[model samples]
Target: MGNAYYKLNKIAESIYYYEKALLLAPNDQEIKTNLSYAQNMTWTL
Candidate 1:
C-alpha cells in the first residue's frame, strides 16, 4: 500500500500509510526501510 504510493511519487501519502503500518508492527524492518525511504524522498523533494 505505502510502497505503491511511493512508486507513484506520492511521498506524503506513502509516509502516511507507512507510519500507520508501523504503528501496527513497530518491529517490521521492511516497513521501517520503506518509511525511511519515503521520508528521504520527501526531504529530497
Candidate 2:
C-alpha cells in the first residue's frame, strides 16, 4: 500500500501508510527503512 502511494508520487500518503505499518510492526527494520526513505523523499522534493 505504501509502495503504491510512493509510485504514484504521493509522498504524504506513502508516509501515512508506512507509519501505520510501523505501528503494527514496530520492530520491523524494513518498514522503518521504507518510512525513512519516504520521509527523505519528502524533504528532497
| lDDT leader | 2
Give me the runs in candidate 2 sitting further than 4 Å from their true place: none
Per-residue accuracy of model 1 over 4-38 as CA lDDT, tens digit each: 99889999999999999999999999999999988
Which regions of candidate 1 are displaced past 4 Å? none
**Worst-scoring 10-residue span by lDDT in model 1:** 36-45
As a whole number from 0 to 100, the lDDT of residue 45 in candidate 1 is 84
Task: Provide the overall lDDT of each model, using Cα atoms, as 2-decimal numbers.
Answer: 0.92, 0.95
Candidate 2 worst ten-residue window by lDDT: 36-45
* CA RMSD per model (angstroms): 0.7, 0.6
Model 2 has an lDDT value of 0.95
